[model samples]
Target: MLTGIVEIVPGVSLLKGRLSSHETTQMLQAEGLAESDLIPGKYEGILLLKAGAEVHFQDYNQEVLRALTAPNVAANTAASGQHAEGCTLRRPRYFAGDWTGLPCLLEKEGLLATYDVILSAETVYNLDSQRHLLKCIKQGLRPKVGQAWIAAKSYYFGVGGGTASFIQLVDRDGTFEVKAVDVIDDGASNKREILLLSFKA
Candidate 1:
């Protein structure tokens, strides 16, 4: 009975020839960016689609379904002492817009405060977009039971937005309680963390 929608943007055609991973890295290096650098409003950190990178709606839909239904699956199995029945998930509706404009967009679609959970990754690296992101989450999440899980690095090297700063913003807003559910430190890069946000009772 839980329905959901996800924003999707049509793939942009690469005007030039496709580049391999190494070639793309070299090109980004020429532009003063390493392979992992996200320049925010300049580069989104995704490789060129023309370089054989592809994103499918089905893949996104599966991920969303898994994230939202995993707990239910476990609970159902535990209660029944058997595997839960498989159910078909509805294809998520799609909209395209910038984070600053997403809340309004969702409102126009009659989806305001409708979601039980929201998931995002590597989206907090831009300091300028964090407020907008928070606004969208605040307006979209259903009351009490709604939650959002954001996965990002402990700090973004060049950009100012990180889990620490975002947590401060959440505290200032006074709308949600935020906690780190997981931390990953491989010593190979910046520490990563998954923060959970939920309405304060």
Candidate 2:
């Protein structure tokens, strides 16, 4: 059984258990000393861990219940965008990659991805996420973990149009983060880009 305040600064005591509802509530009260109105609240937050791990969380009072049943923290999530799940990040930051693919994971317990592997060497000059999506379509790339590919899309600069280059891929575990970047240079025509990063597998 994992225990913590759902909103400690807000004065809430959350709890969870493998027992009956009465037992779960009692366990929470014992942990937090509920002296207030004992208002009912649902576990409103979730942690987006990698796939293939089991986890359970519940919102009771203001405390969050995380069942420490497994090692994966990637599957059990209750919110969208960036989360404040880790011990750091103060107010939790929302990540763009998560917004694109994580919701489906929450619904299906795994990746809900499509494959389109129409890859382009022009990808080096244009690094937009949309371009990556298009390249996925062209190359029949299913976005499995570890394999790398390039994507192209347009970036608008005020009244003008600009192109970008981005390397996009999902690691084997289905965690998708940007692999590299090459902002288009009209003079250079999407020339070779520096290694922005290659996310860990």
**Residues 1-201, candidate 1, lDDT per residue (tens digit)?**
223222222322111123467854554565223333332122111122212322111111222223333323232223231321343222234444456667777778788888777777887877777898899889988989989999999898888889999999999999999999999999998999999999999
Candidate 1 to truth, TM:
0.60
lDDT of each: 0.60, 0.33
Off by over 4 Å in 2: 1-118, 121-146, 151-174, 181-200
Tens-digit lDDT track of model 2 for 152-187: 434333423223323333333233444445544477
| Model 1 misplaced regions, further than 4 Å | 1-85
State residue 160's C-alpha deviation in candidate 2, in Å: 8.5
Worst 10 residues of 1 by lDDT: 53-62
Identify the leading candidate in terms of TM-score. Answer: 1
Native-to-model Cα distance after best TM-score fit, residue 170 in candidate 2, in Å: 8.7
Error of 1 at 81 (Å): 22
Q: How accurate is candidate 1 locally (lDDT)?
A: 0.60
